[model samples]
Target: MTMSISVNARAWMAAGLVLVMAQASISFAQNSKDPIPPKAPAYFPSVANQYVVRLNHEVPALRTSKAFSGIEDRLGASIKEVLRPDLVLIERRNKETRTSALVSLRKNREVAYADPNYIFQALKAPNDVDYSKLWGMSNVGAMVSTKRGLKGVDISAERAWERTTGSKNVIVAVIDTGIDFTIPDLAPNAWTNEKELGGVAGVDDDGNGYVDDIHGYDFVNNDGDPTDDQGHGSHCAGTIGARGDDGLGVAG
Candidate 1:
C-alpha cells in the first residue's frame, strides 16, 4: 500500500526535500577560502554596534542514497563552522518547546549574520482602520476648474502643506500600507536620497545604520527595507507631495 499525506503534510515534505537539496548545493560550493570577503565596519558607529544571526536547524534525511552520504558530512561541517562563531546557540530541550539564545557581541566586532533577502518577505498586517480620510474634514470648499467650471475640492492637503512644509522638514514617516513606486507622477519625486542604504542581507552592506533602506525605514520590525504592503503609503505620499496644476489627482 502507498502512504498518502494531506496538503499541509505534503508542503512540509516538500520543504524537507528542498532543504536536502540546498544542503547538497552548499556542500558542492564549499572551498578552502571564504566565498565573501570581510566587510568593512559600518560608517555610522552608533548603528554598527549591533547585529543578528539566524542559524539553520533543518536535519538531513538518513537515507542510504549515495548522493545523500556524499554531501552529508560536508553539510554538517559547514553548519558546525557557522555555529562555531562567537555567539550563543539555543538548543531545544523537548520536541515541542520554545528556546531563546541571546548573544551580545562587542561594539568593535560584527555580531550575527542573517540572510538579507529575508527582509523583503515581511508579512503585511491588515489595517482595516481608515484613519487618514476618517479623521480629516471631507467636504471643504470649491475651486475654479478649467474643465468642469467651479467644483468642490478636498483642500485639506493643500492647507496642511502650507502650514507644515515651510516651517519644518516635515519628514512625514509614512508607516502604513504599501505604495506603488512605479507611477510616473509619483516616481520622479519619490523620496530619492543618496544617503539611503541598500542590501540583500547578511552584513550591513551600506553602513547607513539600516540595511536595504533605499527608500525609508520600517520601524515596525526594524531594519530598513521600508517598501509598503498596503496602499496607504502611496496615498499618504500623494497627500504630501502631489504637484499642483498637474491635471491629475488632487494636489497637496
Candidate 2:
C-alpha cells in the first residue's frame, strides 16, 4: 500500500509539471504574434498615388542611373523626380549607399508590380488612438485613426512628452513648395528671420541671396510668401509644427 501511494504521488507531481509548462508555452505563442508598434508619435504623412523605391547599392547615381531607367521602362511611368537621401546630420550615409527614386503607377498597375523586388519589408502604421479628437498635444498610449479604422495597438507618445514638448530655438525649415505663414494656428509659431524682416525691404537684407525673406523663400515662384499654392507645403508645415496646446488645429 505504501509503495502504491508513493508512486501515485510522484505521478501527480509529474502531471502538474507538464500542465504548467504547456500553459507557459501557449502564453508565449500568443505574445509572439503581437503587432510591432510604431516609432513616430504622428502618422507618417501620406504619400498619395506615389511609392518611393530604392535601387541596389551596385546601381549608379539617379540622374543617369541604368537601374532608374530600367524601373521606368518596367513601370510604364517615368521617375517624377530624383530624391537625394540627405546625409544624416549626425552620421553621413555610407559612401556606397544609393539614393531612392519616386515612381507613380496607374491605380491598376500598383497591385501588379508589387513583386519581391518592389517590397523589401512590410509597412506598419499605428492605429489605436482617436487622433482626430486627440489634437496630438496629449499623450497617446494607443492612437487609432478614425477615418481609416486601421490598428496600431501598442504605440506610445507619453515618454516623448516627458522629455520635451518642443523648443522655440529650433528652426524646422519646410523646404518643399512653401508654408502658409498666415494660417492662424501656425502664425504664432512661424519661423521668421527677424534679422531679415528688420532690415531694409527690397535689399537682400540678410544677404542670403534672396531679398526680404521675412517668413520663408519660395523656390518654385522665386518669391517670399511661400503661401502654398499647391497646398503641399502647407500640409507639410502643419505636420512639422502646428502650435501645441493652442486649442485650434493638430499639434506638432
Candidate 3:
C-alpha cells in the first residue's frame, strides 16, 4: 500500500512544530540579571559632591553589633542610596575635594576608601516603548508607489520583529545632524537619559562630565537638546528606528 499527505496537512504539521519551539525559546529567555531594582533613595541626591561605593564584600557581613550601621557621616561619607550589595551611592565631602569618586570599602572598616581609578555620579533609568508604522515592514516587496516606481529595496524587518524589535541596552549614535526629539511623532521614541533629565537642567546628572545631555549633545549650539536645526538628522533617525506600525509615523 502507498500513502500520501495533503498540502494542508503538511502545513499543519509544520505549524505545530513551530508553536512548540517558540514556547520553549520563551522559557529559556526568562533570565534574571539584577534580580530586583533597589528601592528609591530616602533623600534627593546631588551628583556633584556625591560618590558611588562598591566594596569587595557586603556591608552587612562586617558589622559587629546591632548598633553598627553601614556608612556614617564621621567616615566623611553619608549613605544616600544602596544600589546593590557591593555598591552604595553616597554623598562625600572633604577639604579641597568637591567632586565624587568610586570607593571600595575594606573588609573591616566602615570608612570609604576612594579609588583613584573609578569615578561616581547620579543614578539613572531608561524606558523602552515603541509605536510606529512602516508599510515596508510586513511586505517590503511591494512598490514604493509614492515615487511612482516599482522597487523592492526591503530587508524583511517584519520577520526579525518576531524575535526582537530593539533593545534599550544598545545605543545607536547617528553621527549626522541632530534629531528633533521635540516632534510629536518622534517624542516617545526619542532617547533621553532618565538620570540627567531627573537632575537640574544645567547640571550633569550621571557625571561623565557632560551636563544636561538628556537627549544628545549639540556641538554646534554648545548646549544640550540636539534638536534638528538641519532636517538631515531627523530624516535619518526616522529611517533608523521610528517605531513600527504606530499608524502615525514610518516604521523604524
All candidates: CA RMSD (Å): 25.7, 27.5, 21.9
**What's the count of clashing pairs in each model shown?**
7, 6, 8
Off by over 4 Å in 3: 1-151
Model 1 global lDDT (CA atoms, 0 to 1):
0.33
Q: lDDT of all the models against the reference?
A: 0.33, 0.40, 0.45
RMSD of 2: 27.5
State how far residue 211 of model 3 sits from its true place (Å): 1.6
Q: Estimate each model's TM-score.
A: 0.32, 0.42, 0.41
Q: Give one digit per residue, the lDDT tens place, for model 2 in 28-110.
A: 01122343222232223222333333322222355477765665565444455433331000111222211222213223332
lDDT of 1 by residue, 1-252 (tens): 111110110111001001101111111112324343243333312111112233223233443656434333422212222323222122222232111112221121332232111111112111213222312212333222544322234443323332222212223344555445664434544554344433455355667666555555666667455555566676655554433334444333
Best by lDDT: 3
Writing each residue's lDDT as its tens digit, candidate 3 over 138-245 gives 333343445532344444444344334565444556566777675554566666677988998788889867678777777655666576767777765665665444
Off by over 4 Å in 2: 1-148, 153-158
* 169: Cα error in model 3, Å: 2.7
Please report how far candidate 2 places residue 223 from its true position, in Å.
2.0
Off by over 4 Å in 1: 1-170, 197-206, 219-224
Clashing residue pairs, backbone N/CA/C < 3 A, model 1: 116-200, 116-201, 117-200, 177-230, 178-228, 178-229, 178-230
Clashing pairs in 3: 132-243, 132-244, 132-245, 132-246, 133-245, 133-246, 133-251, 242-252
